[model samples]
Target: MSATSVPRARRRSAAPPSVDGWELFAPGIRGEGTAARRAWRSRYVRQSAILDAAAAAIAGFAGYYLWFVVFAAYGPRPPLWAVLVFPVVWVPVMLVARAYEERFLWIGVEEYRRVLNAAVLVLALVATVSWGLRLDVARGLVVVTLPLATLLTVSGRLAHRHWLRRARQRGEHLQTTILVGSRETVAALDEQLQRTPEQGYKVIGCCLPSRERSTGADAFNGLPVLGGVTDVVDVVHRFEVDTVAVLPGPEIHGSVLRRLGWQLEDTDAELLLAPAVTDVVGPRVHIRPVAGLPLLHMERPELTGVRRWTKELVDRSAAAMGLLLLSPVLLAIAVAVCLDSRGPVFFRQERVGRCGETFTMLKFRSMVQGAPKLVEDLTRADEGNGVLFKMRHDPRVTRVGRTLRRYSLDELPQLINVLRGDMSLVGPRPPLAKEVEKYGLDMHRRFLVKPGLTGLWQVSGRSDLSWDDSVRIDVRYVENWSLTFDVMILWKTVGAVLRGSGAY
Candidate 1:
């Protein structure tokens, strides 16, 4: 008998084994059951609330001191009671905004977005109450408190998310998951989950379609094939699964899925439905209920329009401001580069931009003189993800160049590219002319937007990513480009550059 095969008599039974008392409890509540299945989620949520409250209190008091005690010493000040009540109001507002929900936590921009929205709402409420009651609320206090509260709250959430990600990476606080779908779909989802362990999914097994289950086969993609589609609940019980992710397919649909949801309710396991769509994000995907059925609606990618125009405006403005602010640093780096290497301070190369337009991309020179001429001799030593030439310790790099590359100081000149509208602050990686020549039809999607100074590629794995992974990330960015997404990438870029793991 196969390892996944159930006995013939047991397979014939429609009713499953009686649910244990521990499995009957609500989500986020601890029960007497498997040690691994304890409710870490409840503790995490409680910790988040405490952190948010603490952040709000600190922001409120700090804002009060800055506005009333220091800056506006002689000006009319709000009562101390108002400052004390600020956190009391702020925490409830965030709760109402669903900022602490598990779905929005540990991943995505939704959590931060909600926090900002809650801050805005609180500001509006404060304004309305002050006007209606003729209260002596200082405008400065309101202005400082709300923004500070939002910032501190977001920072707190980020810290929590970082801690959670670190824990997940170490194989702690992970959701033991089971993939339910055809072998092909299950394998694909498993591959993606494996790539992002911080997402907290640990796929222990899979359940293939009944007809597709091989008699002798017990494993797929290094994961044990637990059973057929019908065996999901049994497998969940036997393994004490935390999550069951069902991929879209014909084998599991209509009443079968509805019944599966009903069955899962009797246990602690949560059901997840993975749409067939790939590379699309939450903002573009919406669910519409029509005729009493939930229908997944996908919005077209925003390639152009007001949002794109706003993005372009912000990119150039930010680049110009960045150049102005970092001028001293840039000049110092230029002098150091010229002193350390007998070459021009700036390196200019032709790179493909939006709509296949060629532009002169600028970078603070990080390679020895005539480095391009040495490419042929060093081709055999290339450790890059093919198509690009990368060497961990390239002989062509100067002493100062290595440090510049490590901290990404070499890319500072790309601000000029952004100012010239040849690149964006955040977008796809700027591909070389030679690299663009090898592009496939799907890869051309990256040209839909201006190449970026820092992007998903830079923050993700940079030079360490495989060629396919690089292309996939770039194309995905193009497909799901948004202002929020860009900000998130820029934020992550700071940490990525600081760690400097994948930089060559």
Candidate 2:
């Protein structure tokens, strides 16, 4: 064997699993000691620190510059020192808000929550201070800064996440993990970790229960068997593992978990339990310890209420303003479609809407005249999921139609639909009358809300989604509808459309 490969190979075979119960197949201990791990982890942390401070400082300075200098709003200016001092004030506010908490960094929406929370508190504090201390600051500056600061921070976070994901994809700054659960569960969990390598998990080995260890296997689903479940502590120390992922199974009971957590208190390894229930995001799932049992409380589905009304108000207002602002672009598209294809400038199709109602959805014509008649001929060669027809290079799409569809310009007419209350700015994609006919009972849940101009389907692969995935995404959207969720989807939609991903 080659010299480098020999050392790694020898380490993997160095010792048998402990007689007590866990396996220890970690090669990382010898190659990557605690010092090495510290060096590797600090790279991302340093990058995050720099970006966080820059975003806050930029937002603070820009807000002051725009209101006091550019527009020169008609109001008494605060002391000149305040402009210079603004960013410095926000840095502490963010620190107090726990904006850079290590647990929240590079994962979850909690980071975004903290950043925005800091912005809100800062604004409220400034208003109170200005009024109470006779500082007479213009109200307009406060108003502009709230959104500007929050937006800039969110932007910086997204860029950092993208950069970190690329780094993780290359196998950098990954947390070493050891799986502790049933062979079956560990195998399944291994698949999950592999599927999302961007999460930066490096599953080095596994610890199976005693009953399942007699299989005479060196590995479980390609992950080395470190030792028996009882040897979790030894294996963790030996590997210097950063995380011990305990998958769902009867073997890892509450007492065992508590003890494991206690033992790991002195070690760097963190014990993470993978709950049996999956696909439920943090917003819907809550934990409350009632009588010592960590009972998971599931929030009821938000089908309609004040939140829905607020969404409706925002949708209509934005749509009306969008139509007025984009009138020139819309007119240009209509003229271009007219010149490219022998079809009406616009195409209207009957689609299933909220509560099983039907409405005419509008779009610029991106197909030849009477394209519906060609569906029968193209049925055998349809590229889309069986229910929704999509063609990446359909002969019926004109040159201009192709260009329009690429960037979603064909969807501009849907702003009118949004204004008319027949659709939302974000929701499930409207199904055709024929497509709805194929609906099973579960599929009907998508009609619980207004059809969307662009939705989970649009931003998450659009025409590329499988039939099952399309239904799943739409149902998930219905069950977890929220204004915040809608805003996030809309923001992602811009990047999705810009890349022309999954658009026909």
TM-score of 1: 0.85
TM-score, cand. 2 vs. native:
0.77
Q: In candidate 1, how many clashes are counted? A: 0
lDDT of 1 by residue, 143-177 (tens): 88788888899999999999999998987787778
User: Which pairs clash (backbone N, Cα, C closer than 3 Å) in model 1?
Assistant: none
Best of the candidates, lDDT: 1
Can you give the lDDT of residue 172 in candidate 1? 73
Candidate models: Cα lDDT each: 0.84, 0.80
Give candidate 1 regions above 4 Å deviation: 1-38, 71-83, 116-143
Query: For every model in order, what is the number of clashing pairs?
Result: 0, 7
Estimate the lDDT of model 1: 0.84
Which tens-of-lDDT digit does each residue in 1-504 have in candidate 2?
211121110122334444233324333344675567657556666666676667666766677778889998877777655654666777778888987667887898888899889988888899889789988777777677667767887888888888889998987777788899998788767766765789988888889998888986876565678888789999878767888999867778888888888999988788898887655565788999999899888888777788888999999999999999999999898889887868689999999899999999999999888989998999878887666778888998889989989999999999999999999999998888887877878789988899898888888788877676677688888877888899889999999999999999
